[model samples]
Target chain A: MDIVLGQLFTGLSIGSILLLVALGLAIIYGSMGVINLAHGEFVMLGAYSTWLLQSAFGLPFLACLVLVFFMVAFAGWVVERGVVRFLYYRPLDTILATWGIGIILQQAVRLSAGAELRYVQTPEALAGSIDLLGIAIPSYRLFILAVTAGLLLLTWFLVQHTEFGMKLRAVTQNREMASCYGINSSRVFSLTFAFGSGLAGLAGALVAPIKSVAPDMGTNFVVDAFMVVVVGGVGSLLGTVASSGILGGSTAGLAFLLNDTLAKALVFLAVVVLIRFRPRGLFVDRVRR
Target chain B: MSRIKSPSHAWPPANSSAPPAAARPSLPQRASYVQILVYLAFCLLILAVPLVIDDAFLLNKYARYLALGLAAAALSLSWGYSGILNLGQGVSFGLGAYAIAMHLKLKTSPVHTGAAGLPDFMVWNNVQTLPWFWEPFHSTLFAILAGMLLPVIVASLLGWFMFRARIVGVYVAIITLAMLVVTNLLFIDQQRYTGGFNGLTDLAWLEIGGVEFDPYSPTFYYLTAGCLSVCLLLGLALTRSKAGLILRAIRNDVDRVRFFGYDVAAYQILAFAVSAGMAGVAGMLYAMVLEFASPTFMGVPLSLSMVIWAAVGGRGSLLGATIGAILVNFMQGSLSETFLDTWQLILGALFILVVLFLPNGLASLIDMAGERLGRAPPRARTEEPAAAAPRAMGTFNTKQRG
Candidate 1:
C-alpha cells in the first residue's frame, strides 16, 4: 500500500508535465486550426534557452525561465507570420509545413549541441526529497505539482475572466462572426499561437531539470501530448487537463509496475479505444449545428 | 483548328497558372500513336537498365529504390486518388518488415542448430522456446499471410473509425501519427518478442523449394523487379478504373460526391486497405533486400517523406511517382554518402522548395511548358515558359492527379 501511494505521487508528477505540454497544444489547435508538429520544438527551444541563460549568462532559475518563454514565444510569432499564416484553410498542409520546420529545428539543435544529452540543475529550493508519512517523496516532484497547478489557474483566469480571452475564444468559436463584430482574428491568431508556444517553452525549462535535455527530447513528450489532446478532445483545454491526468497517471502508475515503453504503449492503446468510443471525448460543448 | 488557334493563344492570360502555358504549340487532344509508343519504349529502356547493369551492387541498390517507389505509388493511390492521406502506410511497411525479420532471425538461431528454435534475439532475451506470437510466423507461408493480412486488417479498422467519424485534414493526420507512435513503442517494448531498440537483425537468406535464396543474387533482383512492376500495374489499373475516378472526385469535393449517392466512407476505407496492403508487400520485399528491419522504418519522419516523394513527383502523374521515388532515393543515397551529416538540411530545404515553388510538382513542369509553347500567342515569347502563366497557390488550387 505504501508503494502504491508512492507510485500515485509519481503519477501526479508525470501528469503535471503532460498537463503543461498538452494545454499548450490544445489552446493553439483551438485558436489556429493547426496541429503544430513543431509545437514540441518550442519546448525544446525553451530548454535550450534556459540552458544558455543559466550556463552562459549566470542567471538565476526564475530569470532564466522567464527569458526562455519570451524567446521561444517570439520565435513562435515569427513562425506564425512567416509559414503558418499561409496555411489556415489547408490544415493538412500546415501539419506538413510545421513538421518540416520541426525537422529543421531539431537538426539545427543537433548541430549546435551535438547529439549528447545535457543536464540542467534544479535550484537548491526544489532539490532533494520530502518525507510524507512512511514514504519519502521527491520535493522537486511536489514543486512541479505546485507550479503546474499555479499555471493552470493562471491559464484559466486569462482565458475565462479576461477581455482578451473573450476575444480569443470568440474568434475560435466563429472567426467570421468575431471579425464582423470588429475583432481582428488574425492578430488574435498570432497572439494565441505565440502564447501557446511560450507555454510549451516554459514546460521545457521546467522539465529539463528532471528529464534529459537533448535535441530530440520533444519527440518523446510530443507523443504523449498528442495522445492527451486526442483523448481529451482537441480545442477543449479543460478536457486536456482531465485527459492528461487520466493518461499521465495511468501511464506513470503502469511504468512503476511494467517498463516505461510498455506503459506508453498501453496508454496509447487506451486512448485509441477511448477515442473510438467517444469521438468528441468525455466532455465537449453541446453544438446546435 | 480555328477554335484551337484563338482560344489556345488566349488561354494562359485568363487561367493565371503563370506556367509553361505560353511556350509550346497546343498538343492535340489525341496524342500521336508514336508518342505513346515512344513513352512505352522509354519505360522499357528503364527496365532494361536494371537488367543489363552487370554490376550486382548497382542492380540491387536500385532494387531497394524500386521498393520505395512501390511504397510511393501506394501512397499516391490512397492520398492522391482517394484524398485520404493515409499516414500509416509506413507503419504497415514496418509491420511487414518486422514479420520477415522475425522469420529470418528465427531461422538462423543457434537454438535451431540442433532443433527447431526461436529467434536468436528472443533467446538472447531469455526465451527457451518460441513465444505464442512467434508460432504462426515460423512457417514461410503463414508468415507471409500474417504480414499481408495484419496490416490490411489494422488499416481497415483504423479507416472504419476515422472515416466513420468524418475526420479529415489535420485530425486524420494526427490520428495516424498517433497510431504510428503507439505501434512503434509497442514493438520496441515487447523486447521479449521484438528485440527492442536493437530490432530484428542479422537475417539470413530465405530458402524455398530446396533452392538457396541469396538476398544478393540476381534471382532476388528479378523477383523484386517483377514485384515492382506488378504493384505499379495494379496501382495504375486501379486509378484507371471507374472506382479510381470516383475516388479522385471525392478528393476534389466530398460533399458533391455524397450528393451523387455514393457511400464516401466505403470508398475511402477500401482505398486505405488497398494502399496498406501494397505497403505491406513492399515492406516484405524491403526486409528481403535490406536483410534488416528496425523501428525507424515507421518513424513519423519516414511517413512524412513518403508524402514528400509523391508531391515532388507530381501526385497527379502516376508515372511521376516511380520516377520521383527512384530519383529521390538516388539523390538521398549519393548525397548522404558524400555529405554525411549535412544531408538532412538539404532534404528539408528541398521539401520546403517543392511545396512553395512547384506545387504541381516536377512532372507538371513539362506539361505546363508544353502547353504554353504550343498554344500561346507569339507575343509571349519573351516570358519564361515555366513561369509565363499566373500561379495558383492555395488549398482550393490543389491540382488534379492521374
Candidate 2:
C-alpha cells in the first residue's frame, strides 16, 4: 500500500511536469496551428536563464523564475515576428522553420554557455521532503505541483475570463470575422505565441533543478510534451491535464513493472496504438467546426 | 520522354466543357532535356571521382557522402513527390546498417569474438549463445536482403497505420519523430543484443563472390556509387510513373483524390515503403564505409539533416536532393574541419534561409536558369496552396467530432 501511494505520488509529480511543459505547446498548436518545434529551445532558454541568474547575479530561484518567464517570452516574440510570422501561411513549412530555429537556439546556447552540463540550486525552503499520511514527498515536487496548478488556473482565467481571451477565441474561430470586428488577429496570434512560449520557459525554470541542464535537454522534454498534447487532444485544456495524468501514471506504473527503458518504449507503443484508434486524441472537441 | 503523360488527367477537368486529351496542348515533361543532361553529367562526375582523387581516404569519404545522397533521394520520393515528410527516416537507415553490421560481426575472426564466436558485446554481456534474431544475419545474402527489406517492412507498417488513419502533414512528421526517439532509446537500451552506445564496430570487409570490398578500395567506392545511381534512377522513374502522378495529385489535395476513388493510403504506404528501402540500402552502404552501426544513426540530428538535404537540393527533384545531400555533407565535413564549432550554427541558419526563400530548393534556381537560357519550357511551380495552411488551421479550431 505504501509502495502504491509512493508510486502515485511519483506519477502525480511526473504529470505536473508534463503538464507544465505541454501547456504552452497545447495553446500555440491549438490556437495558431503552428507546430512550434523550437518550443523545447524556449524551455532550454528558461533553464539557462535560471542558471545564469543564480550564478551570475546571485538571484533567488523564485526571482529567476519570474524574470526567466518574461525573458523567454520576449525571445519567443522575436522568433514569431522574425521567422514564424512569414511561415504562418505554410503550416508544414513552419515545422521545418521552427525546427531550424530550435537548432540555432540550441547551438547558440552551446556556444555561449559552453557544452558542459550546468546545475541550478534548489531553494533552501524547498530542499527537504514533507510527510503526508506516512508518505514522504519532496518539497520541490510539491512546489512544482503548486506552480503547475497555479499556472493552469492562471491560463484558464486568461483564456476564459479576459478581453484578450475573448479576442483570441474570436480570432481562432474565424479570423476574417474577428478582423471585421477590429480584432487584430495577427497581434492575438503573436501574443498567444509569446504567452505560450513564456509558459514553456516557466516550465523549464521549474524543471531546472530536477533535470540536468544541457543545450539538447529540451529535445526529450519537447517530445514528451508533444505526446501529452497529442494524446490529450489538441486545443483542449481539460484534455491536456487529463492526458498528462494518464500518461504520467502509466509511465510510472510501467516503469515499476518493467525496467525504465522498456517502460518508455512501451508507453510510446501504447500512444501509437492509442493514436491508431483515436486519431484526434482521447478528448474530442465537440465545439470545433 | 514520349512515355510521359499529363498527370493532370488524373483529376477531373476544372470546367465541365474541357477539351479531350488529344485536343489539349502537350504538357511539359517532369524533367526537361537539359535537366536529364545535367543528371547524366552529375552521374559522370561521380563515376569519375576515383580517377581524379587517387587518395584512398578521400575516395572512402566520398563513398559515404554518396550513400547519404541516396538516402536524401529516397526522402525526396516520399516527401517531395508524395508529400509525406517522414522525420524518422533514420530509423530505416539505422536498421539497414545494423543488419549488415551483424553479418560482418559474425564473420569477424575469433580475436574480436573470443572463443564463443558471439559478438564482442554479447560476450561482454555474458550472453552465451547468439540471440535468435541474430541467427539469420549470419548469411551474407540474408543480411543484404534484410538490410533492404527490414526498413520496408517497418515503414509499410508505420505508413499503413498513419495513412489509414488519415494522419497527414505535420502530424505525420511528429509521429515519425516520436518513433525515431523511441527506436533510438530501444537501440541504446538493449546493449546486450545491440552494442549499446558503442554500437557494432570492428567489422570485416564485405566479401562478395570471394572478392573483398575493402572500405578504402576503389571497388567499394564503385559499389556505393553504383547502388546510389540505381536508386536515383529508380526514384526518377517512379516519380514519372502513373502512380507517382496520383501520389503528387494526392499531395496537392488529398480529399479531391480520395473523392475520385483512389486508394490514397495504399499509394502513400507504397511510396513510404519504397523510400524506406532506399534509405535502408543507403544505411547498409554507410555501415560498410564507416565500418560500424551506432545508435546515433537514428538520432534526431541525422534525421533532420536528411530533411535539410532534401529541402536544400529541392524535394521536388530527386537528383536535386541527391546533389543537395552530397553538397551539404561535403561542405559540412570541410567547414567543420576548418571552423570547428560554428558549422552547426551555419547549417541551422542555412536551413532556415532555404526553407524561407528557396521553398523549391537550389534545384529551382537551376530550373530558372534553364528557362532563361531557353532550354526548358515555363512550367507551373508546384507550390503548396496558400489556402491549405489556413484551412488546416480552421479545421483544428473546428474539427468535427467523430
Candidate 3:
C-alpha cells in the first residue's frame, strides 16, 4: 500500500508537468491543426527568460516567473504572426518547417549560452520536504502540482466559460461557418496560439528548477511530448490528460521495478498496441484516419 | 521534350479545377543490354575513386560512405517506393548496431577478459551477472540472427497495428518520432546493461574459424564492398518483383488497394521487414569497419542526416539516394573541417535551396539537363535517358483501383 501510494504521487507530479506541455500542444494542434514541433523550444525560451532575469538583473525567482510569462507570451505572439500563421493550413509542411526552426533556435541558443547546461536555483520557499499523511514527499513536487492545477483551472475557465473561450471554440469547430457568422478566426488563431505558447513557456520555467537549462536539453523533451500528444490524441484535451496519466505513471512506476529500457519499450509497445485498436488515439472520433 | 503532353498538364495547372489532369508518361522502354552495360560502367568508374585518393583515411571515408549507401538503399525501399515515411528506421539500424556492440564488448572487455560474459560497462554499472537478455547474445550466430529478427518482429508488429488502424501522414510520423525518443532515452537510462550515454566499446578484431584476418585489414574493405554489392542485388530483386509493385501501389493508393481486396498492411510489413534486415546488414558492416559500436551510431543526428541524404538525393532513385548519401556526407565532412564556424549556416542555406528549388532532389537535375539535351541535336536524341527517378506512372492510374 505504501509503495503504491508513493508511485501514485510520483506519477501525479510527473503528469502535471506533462499537462503543462501538452496543454499548449492540444490547443494549437486541436484547434488550429498545427503541430508546432518547436513547442518544446518555446519552453526552453521560457526557462532562459527565467535565467536571464535571475543572473542579469538579480531578480527574485517568483517575481521573474510572472514577468517572463508575459514577455515569453509576447514573443510567442510575434512568432505566430511572423511565421507559424503562414503554416496553419499545412500540417506536414509545418512540422518540417518548425523542425528547421527548432534546429536554428537550438544553434542560436548554443551560440548565446555556450553549449552547456546552466544551473538554476529553486526558490527558498519551495525547497525541502513536507509530510503527506504518513509519507514524506518533496515540497517542490507538491508545489508544482499545486501551481499546475491552479493554472489548469484558470486556463479551463478562460477557455470554457469566457466570451473569448466561446469565440475560440467556435473557430475550431467550423472555421468557414464561424467566419460566416463573423467570428474573426484569424484573430482567434493568433490569440490562442500566443496564449498556448505562454503556457509552454511557463512549463519551461517550472521545469528549469528541476532540470538544468541547456541548449540541447529541449531536444530530448520535444520527442517525449510528441508521445504524450499521440497517447492523449490529437485535437482532444481529455485524451491527452488520460494518456499523460497512464504514460507518466507507467514509465516512472515501471522504472522503479524494471530496467528503464524495458519500461520505455513497454510504453512504446503500449502506444503501438493502442494505436492499432484506436488508430486516431485512445479516443474515438467520426473522422476516419 | 515531348512538347507539353497536354496543355492542361502544366504545374499549378493554369487553374485549380482542371478536369483531374492526364496521366504522366509511361516507363520508357529504351534500355537495351548495351545501355545497361554503359550505366554499370559509369557507376564502376565512380567506385574506382579510392585508387586515386591513396590516403588510407580517404579510402576508409569512401568505404564508410559505401556502407551508408547500403542503409540508404534500404531506407529508400520503404520510404521512397512504399511511402510509409517510417521515421524510426534508425531504431532498427540501432538494434543491429547494439547487437554487434554486445558481442564486441564481451569479446574485448578487460574485466570479463573472456568472450563469454557481461561487458565491463555492465559490470561498472553494477550488474551482478549477465542478464537473461544477454544469454541469447552469447553465440555469434544467434546474436546476428536476433539482431535481424528483433527489428523485423518489431517493425512488422508496428506496421500491422499502424496500417491496419489507418494511421497515416503526420500522425504516423509523430508516433515514430516518439518511438525514436523513447528508444534513445531508454538506451540512455539503462546504464547497467546498455552503457547509457557512453554506450559499449573496446571491441577487438573478429575472425571466423582459422581465419586470422584483422578487422581493419584490406580484406575487410573488400568484405564490406562485397556486402554492399549483395545488398544492392537484393534491393534490385525486391524492387523488380511483383511484390515490389504491390508495395508501390500501397504507397500511392492504400484505399484503392483495399478496394481491390489486397491486404495492404501485410505488404507494408514485408517492405518494412526487408528494409530492417538490410539495415542490419549495414550495421554488421559498420561494426566490422569501425571495430567499435556506440549509441552514437544510432543517434538522432545520424538518423536525421540519413533522411536528409535520401530526400536530397531524390528518394525515388536508388542511385540518386546512394549518391546523395556520399555527396552530402563528404560535403559535410570537408565543410565542417574547413569552415568550422559557418558550416551550419552553409548547410541550412543548402537545405532551403534543396527544399524550395530541387524538391525532386539532386537526381532531378540530371533529368532537367537531359530534357534540355533532348533538343540539343539529332545526335543526342538517339542516346537514351538515364532512369532519372523511378516514375511509377501507374501510381496516378486511379482506374487500377477498380
Candidate 4:
C-alpha cells in the first residue's frame, strides 16, 4: 500500500513536469500552427538564466523564475519576428528553419556557457520532505505541482475568458474574419508564441535543480513535450493535461515494474499505437469548418 | 500561351501560319543535352578521383563522402520528389550499419572474441552462447541482405501507419524525430547485445570471392563509388518515372490527387520505403568505410546534417542533393579542422539562409544561370512550384487554402 502511494506521488510529480514542459508547445502548435522545433532551446535558455541568476547575481530561485520567463519570452519573440514570420505561409519549411535556429541556439549556449553542466540550488524553504499517507513527498515536488496547477489555471483563464485568448481562437479558426473584426492576427500569434516560450522557460527553471542543466538537455525534453502534445491532441489544453498524466503515470508504473529504459521504450510504443488508433489524439475538439 | 516571334518573322501577315512545333521540340532537346552533359561530367569526375589522388587516406575519405552523397540522394527521392521529411533517416542508416557490423565482428580473430567465439561484450555480460538474432548475421550474404531489407521493412511499416492515418507534413517530421530518440535509447540501453555506447568496433575487412576490401584500399573506394553511382542513377530514373510524377502531384495537393482516384498512402509508402533502402545501403557502405558501427550514427546531429546536405544541394534535384552532400561534407571536414567550435554555427546560419532566400538550394542557382545562358523562357520544372507553395499537412487549417 505504501509502495503504491509512493509510486502515485512519483507519478504525479512526473506528470506535473511533463505538463509544464508541454503547455507552451501545445499553445504555439494549436494556435499558430507552427511547429517550433527551437522550443527546447527556449527551455534551455531558461535553465541557463536560472543558473546565471542564482550563481552570478545571488538572486533567489523564485526571483530568477519570474525574470527568466520574460527574458526567454523576449528571445522567442525575436525568433518569431526575425525568421518564423516569413515562413508562416510555408509551414513545412518552418520545421527546417526552426531546426536550424535550434542548432544555432544550442551551439551559442555551448560556446557562451563553456559546454559544461550548470547546477541551480533548490530553495532552502522547499528543501524538506513532508509525510503524507505513509509516503514522504519532497517539498520541491509539491512546489512544482502547485506551480504547474497555478500556471494551468492561468493559461486556461487566459485562453478561455480573456480578450487575447478570444483573438487567438478567432485567428486560429478564421484569420481573414479575425482580421476583418480588427484583431491583429500577427500580433496575437507573436504574443501567443512568446507566452508559450515563457512557459517552456519556466519549466526549464523549475526542472533545473532536479535535472542536470546542459545545452543538449532540451533535446530530450522537447521530444517528451512533443509526445505529450501529440498524444494530448494538438490544441486542446484539457487533452494536454490528461495525456501528460497518462504518459507520466504509465512511465512511472512501467519503470517500477520493469526498468527505466524499457519503460521509456514501452511508453513510446504505447503512444505510437495510441496514435495509430487516434490520429488527432485523445481529446479532439469538434470544430466545424 | 504567348509566343515570342523571332525578329525575322513577319507575324502580322501570316494569319494561317501554324506554330513551329519543330522549334519547340529543339528547346527541350537542348535542355536535355545540357543535362546529359552535366551528368556525364559528374560521373567522369567521380571515376577520375582515384587517378588524380594517389593518397590512400584521401581516397578512403572521398569514398565515405560518396556514401553520404548516396544517403542524401535517397533523402531527396522522398523529401524532394515525394515531400516526406524523414528526420529519423539515421535510424535506417544505423540499423543497416549494425547488421553488417555484426557479421564483420563475428569474423574477427579470437583476440577480440572470447571462448565459444562470443563477442567480447557478450562475454563480459555473461552470455555463454551467441544470441538468436546474432546467429543469422554470421553469414555475410544474410547480413548484407538484412542491412538493406531491415530498413525497408521498418520504413514501410512506419509509412503505412503514418499515411494510413493521413499524418502529413510537419507531423511526419515530429514522429520520425521521436522515433530517432526511442531507437537511440534502445540501442544505447541494450548494452549486453548492442555493445552499449562503444558499439561494434575492431571489425574484420569484408571479403568476397577471394578479394578483401580494406577501408584504405582503392578497391574499397571503387566499391563505394560504384554503389553510389548505381543508387544515384536508380534515384534519377525513379524521379523521372510516372509514379514519381504522381508522388510530386501528391506533394502539391494531396486532396486533389485523392479526388483523381489515386491511392495517396500507397505512393507515400513506396517512396518512403525506397528512400529507407537507399539509406540502408549507404549505412552498409559507411560501416565498411569507417570499420565500425557506433550509436552516434543514429544521433540527431548526423540525421539533421543529412537534411542540411539535401537542402543545400537542392532537395528538389537528386543529383544536386548528392553533390551538395559531397561538397558540404568535404567542406565540413576541412573547415572543422580550422574553425572547430564555430563550424556548427556556420552550418546552422547557412542552412537558414538557404531555406529563406534560396529554397530550391544551390542547384537552382545553376539552373537559373543555365536558363539565362540559353535565353529560353524557364521551363515548367516539377520542383519549382512545389517548393514555392507546399501544401500543409491534412489536419491543420492553413490560411493559404481558404
Candidate 5:
C-alpha cells in the first residue's frame, strides 16, 4: 500500500512535468497549425539558460526561471519570424524546417558548451524529503508539482480572460474572419508562438535540477511531450492535462513493477494502440472546412 | 440538327496544323540519350576513381559512401515515388547489418569465449547454449538471405497496418521514429543476444564459395560498387513500370486511384517492402565496409540523415538521391576534419535552406543544366515533359491538376 502511494505520487510529479513541457506544443500546434519539431530544442535552450544564469551570475533559481522564460520566448519569436512564418500552410515542409532548426540548435549548443553534461544546483529549501502517511517524497518533486499547477492555471486565465488571448483564439479559429475584425493575425501568431516557447522554457528551467542539462537531453523530453500532446488531443488544454496524468501515472506504476526500459516500451506500445483507436486523439474539436 | 448547327459548332480549327513530323521533338528519345550518357559517366567514374586515387583509405571511404547511397535511394523510392516518408529507415538497415554481423561474428570464431563456436559476447554473458535465433545464421547462405528478408518482412507488416488504415504523412513519420527508438532500446537492453551497447565486433573477412573478400582490397570496393549499380538499375526499372505510374497517381490522390478500383494499400506496402529490402542490402554492405554492426545504426539521427541525403540529392530523382547521400556525407567527412564544431551547424543550416529554397534539390539543378544543353532549348525546365520526368509526388501534383 505504501509502495502504491509512493508510485502514485511519483506518477503525479512526472505527469506535472509532462504537462508543463507539452503545454507550449499544444498551444503552438493549436493556434499556428505548425508542428514545431524544434519545440524540444527550446526546452533545452531554457535549461541551458537557467544553468548559465545560476552558475555564472549566481542568480537565484526563481530569478533564472523568469529570465529563461523571456530569453527562450525571444528565441522562439525570432525562429517564427525567420522560418516558421513562411511555411504556415505547408504542414509537411514546416515539420522538416523545424527539424532542421532543432538539429542546428542542438549542434550549436554542443559546440558552445561541449558534449559534457552540466548540473544545476537544486534550491536548498527543497533539497530535503517530506514524509506523508508513511511515504517519503522529495520536497523538490512537490515543488515542481505546485509550480506546474500554478502555471497551468495562469495559462488558463490568460487564454480565457485576456483580450490578447481572445484575439489569438480568434485568429486560430479563422484567420480571414479575425483579420476582417481588424486583428493583426501575424502579430498574434508571433506573440502566441513566443508565449508557448516561454512556457516550454519554464518547464525546461524547472527540470534542469532533476535531469542533467545537456544538448541532446531535449530529445528524450520532446518524444514524451509529443506523446502527451498527441494522446491528449490537440487544441484542448483539459485533454492534455487528463492524458498526461493517465500516461504519467501508468508509466510510473509500470516502472515500479518492471524495469525502466521495459516500462518505456510498454508505454510506447500503449500510445501506439491509443493512436490507432483515436487518430485525432481524445478531444477533437469540430471545424468548418 | 444540321440546320441548327452554327459555323462555331463545326469542327474546331486544326491545332496541330503547323507541326512537321520531322521537326517535332521525340521527348523520350532525347531525354533517354541524356540519361544514358549521365549514367555511363557515373559508372565510368565509379570504376575509374579507385585506380586514380592512390590512397586505399579514400577508396574504402568512397565505397562506404556508395553503400549509404543505396539506402538513400531506397528512401527516394518510398518518399519520392510513393509519397511515404519513412523516418525509421535505419531500422531496416540496422537489422540487415546485425544479421550479417552475427554470422561474421560466428564465422570469425574470435578468442576469449569460454564456449567454443559461440560469440565472445554471448560467452561473456554466461550463455551455456546457442540461442535458437542464432542457429540459422551459422550457414552463410542463410545469413545473407535473412539479412535481405528480415527487414522486408518487418516493413511489409508495418506497411500493412499503416497503409490499410490510410495513415499517411506526418503520422507515418512519427510512428516510424517511435519504432526506431523502440528497436534501439531493445538492441541495447538484450545484452546477452545483441552485445549490448558495445555492439558486434571482431569480425573476420567475409568469405563466399571458398573465396575470401578482405575489406582493404579493391575486390571489396568493386563488390559494393556492383551492388549499388544493380540497386540503381532496379530502381530505374521500377520507376518506368506500370505499377510505378499507378504508385505516383496514388501519391497524387489516393481517393482518385481508389475511385478507379485500385488497391492503394497493396502498392504502398509493396513500395515499402522494396525500399526496406534495398535498405537491408545497403546495411549488409555497410557491415562489410565498417567490419561491425552497432546499435547506433538504428538511431533516429541516422534515419533522419538518410532523409536529408534523399532530400539534398533530389527526392524526385533516384540517381539524385544516391548522389546526394554520397556528396553530403563526403562533405560532412571533409568539413568535420577542418571545422569540427561548425560542420553540424552548417549541415543544419543547409537542411533548412534546401527545404526553403531548393525543395527539388541539387538533382533539379542538374536536370535544368541538362535541359539547357538539349538541342531544342528545353520547354521551361520547370515544366518537364510528363514522359521524360517522373516527378509526381504529394502537394505539387495538386498545382499541376489546377
Candidate 6:
C-alpha cells in the first residue's frame, strides 16, 4: 500500500512536468498548426539558462525560473519571426525546419557547454523530504507538483477568461472570421507560440534539479511531450491534461514493475494502439464554427 | 520513353476540374538532349572516381557513400514520388543489415559436434540452444532472401495500417518515428541475441563461391556500385511509369484518386514496400562494406538524415535525391573529419536554409538551366505543390474542425 502511494505521487510529479511541456505544444500546434519539433530544444535552453543563472549570478531557483522562461520565450519568439512564420501553412516543412533548428540548438549547446552534463541546485527551502501517510515524498517533487498545478490553473484562466485568450481561441478556430473582427491572427500566432515556448522553458527549469541538464536531454522530453499531445488530442487543453495523467501514471507504474526500456516500449505500443482506434485522440472537440 | 502513348490519349487530365487531356497540348515524352547529356556526364564522373582517387581506403569510402545514396533514393521513391513520408525507413535498412550480419556471425562461429553453431553473444549469455529465429539464417541464401523480404513485409504491414485508417501526413511521420524508436529499443534490450549497445562486429570477409569479397579489395567497391546503379535505375523506371503518375495523383488529392476508381491504399503500400525492399538491399550492402551492423542503423538521427538527403537532392527526382545523399554525406564525412566541433552546426544550418529557400532542392537549378538552354517552356514536374507555403496556411485555417 505504501509503495503504491509513493509510486502514485511520483507519477503525478512526472505527469505534472509532462503537462507543462505538452500544454505549450498543444497550444502552439492548436493555434498555428505548426508542429514545433524544436520544442524540446526550448526546454533544453531553459535548463541551460537555469544552470547558467544559478552558477554565474547565484540567483535563487525561483528567480532563475522566471528569467529562463523569458529568455527561452524570447528565443522562441525570434525563431517564430525569422523561420516558423514563413512555414506556418506548410506543416511538413515546418516539421523539417524546426527539426533543423533543434539540431542547431543541440549542437550549439554541445559546443558551448563542452558536451558535459550540468546540474542546477534545488532551492534550499525545498531540499528535504516530508512524510505523509507513512510514505516519504521528496520536498522538491512536492514543490514541483504544486507549481505545475498552479501553472495549469493560471494558464486555464488566461486562455479561458482573458481577452487575449479569447482572441487566440477565436483565431485558432476561424482565422478569417477572427481577422474580419479586427483580430490580428499573425500576432496571435506569434504570441501563442512564444507563450507555449515559455511554458516549455518553465518545465525545463523545474526539471533541472532532478534530471541532468545536457545538450541532448530535451530529446527525451520532446518525444514524451509528443506522445502526451497526440494521446491528449490536438486542439484540446483538457485532453492534454487528462492524457498526461494517464500516460505519466502508467509509465511510472510500469517502470516500477518492469525495467525502464520495456516500460517505455509498452507505453509506446499502447499509444500506437490507441491512435489506431481513435485517430483524433481520447477527446474529440465538437465545437462548431 | 515512346512506349507509353501520348499523354492526351493514354492518361486523364491531372486536375479533375480541368479540360479533357485531348484538348490540352501533349506533354513531352522524353528527357531533352541536355538532360541526357547531364546524366551521361554524371555517369562518367562516377566511373572515373576510382581512377582519380587511387587510394583503396578512399575508394571504399566512396562506395559506402554510393550505398547510402541508394538508400536515400529509395526514400525518395516513397517520400518524394509517392508522398508517403515514412520516417522509419532505417527500421527496414537495419533489419536487412542484421539479417546478413547474423548469417556472417553464424558462419564464423566454431561448429559443435552435435549442435548447430551458435553466435558468440548467444554463447556468452548462457543460451543453451540456438534460438529458433537464428536457425534459418545459417543458410546464406535464406539469410539474403530474408534480408530483402523482412523490410518489405514490415513496410507492407505499416503502410496497410496507416493508409487504411486514413492516418497520413504528419501523423504518418509521427507513427513511423515511434515505430523506429520502439524497434531500436527492442534491438538494444535483447543484448543476448543482438550484442546490446556494442553491435555485431568482427565479421569475417564474405565469401562467394570460393572467392573472398574482402572489404579492402576493389571487388567490394564494385559490388556496392553495382547495387547502387541497379537500385537507382529501378527507382527511375518506377517514377516514369504510368503507375507513378497515379501515385503522384494520389499525393495531390487522395479523395480525387479514390473518385477516379483507384485504390489509394494499395498504391501507397506498393510504393512503401518497394522502397523498403530497396533500403533492405542497401542495408545488406552497407553491412558487407562496413563489416558490422549496429542499432544505430535504425536510429532516429539516421532516419532523419535520410529525409534530409532526399529533400536536399530534390525529392522530385530520383537521380537528384541520390546526388543529394552523396553530396551531403561526402560533405559530412570531410567536414566532420576536418572540423569535428562545428560540422553538425553547419549541417543543421544548411538543412534549415535548404528547406526555407531552396524548396525545390539543388536539382531545380539544373532544371532551370535546362529550360533556358533547351529553349522549351518549363515543363511541370510531377504533382508537387509548387508554392506550397502561403496557400497552405490559408487552407489549414479554413479547414480547422473547430
DockQ of each model against the real complex? 0.27, 0.47, 0.20, 0.35, 0.28, 0.42
- What TM-score goes with each of the models? 0.88, 0.93, 0.83, 0.92, 0.92, 0.92
RMSD of each: 6.5, 5.3, 6.3, 6.6, 6.9, 5.7
Candidate 5 TM-score, true structure as reference: 0.92
Candidate 2: tens digits of C-alpha lDDT, residues A152-264: 99999999899999998887776667888999888988999999999999999999999999999988888899889889987789999999999899999988998788788
Please give the CA lDDT of all the candidate structures: 0.75, 0.85, 0.69, 0.84, 0.82, 0.80
Error of 2 at B11 (Å): 20
> Which regions of candidate 4 fall more than 4 Å away from where they truly are?
B1-26, B336-338, B375-402
Q: Write the per-residue lDDT of candidate 3 for residues B1-402, one digit (tens) a residue.
A: 000011123222222321222421222324323334544663565556645665666666666777787778777887777776666767787888788667766666455543346577766666777888877665777777877777778778777767767777565676676676567767777787788878767775555565633554455566666666666656766876789889877766677778999888888878888888887777766766676666777666667666667767876666677778878778766664546445554554465455444544787787668567663223224333222121222122111110
Q: Which DockQ-derived CAPRI band holds candidate 5?
A: acceptable
Off by over 4 Å in 3: A1-5, A70-90, A161-167, A176-190, A259-262, A284-289, B1-27, B31-46, B105-119, B122-150, B181-196, B208-219, B336-342, B345-358, B372-402
Supply candidate 2's per-residue lDDT for A176: 66
Candidate number achieving the greatest lDDT relative to the actual structure: 2
Candidate no. 2 TM-score: 0.93
Order candidates by lDDT, high to low.
2, 4, 5, 6, 1, 3
Candidate 1 deviant stretches above 4 angstroms: A286-289, B1-46, B109-116, B132-139, B208-213, B336-338, B375-402
lDDT of 5 by residue, A76-140 (tens): 99999999887654456677788889999998999888789999999999999999999889999
lDDT of 1 by residue, B205-322 (tens): 7776777666666777776677777777677678767888788777766777889999989999988988888888888888888888888888877887888787788666556766
Model 5, runs deviating above 4 Å: B1-25, B336-338, B371-394, B397-402
DockQ of 3: 0.20
lDDT, residue B83, model 5: 82
Q: Proportion of native contacts found in each model?
A: 0.28, 0.41, 0.17, 0.35, 0.29, 0.39
**Which segments of model 2 are wrong by more than 4 Å?**
B1-33, B336-338, B378-402
Worst 10 residues of 1 chain A by lDDT: A280-289
Any residue pairs clashing in model 3, and if so which? none
In model 5, pairs of residues that clash are none
* Clashing residue pairs in candidate 2 (N, C-alpha, C atoms within 3 angstroms): A288-B398, A289-B398
Compare candidates 3 and 4 on DockQ and give the better one.
Answer: 4
Query: Candidate 2 docking category?
Result: acceptable
- The parts of candidate 6 lying over 4 Å away from their true place are B1-27, B32-48, B109-117, B336-338, B378-402
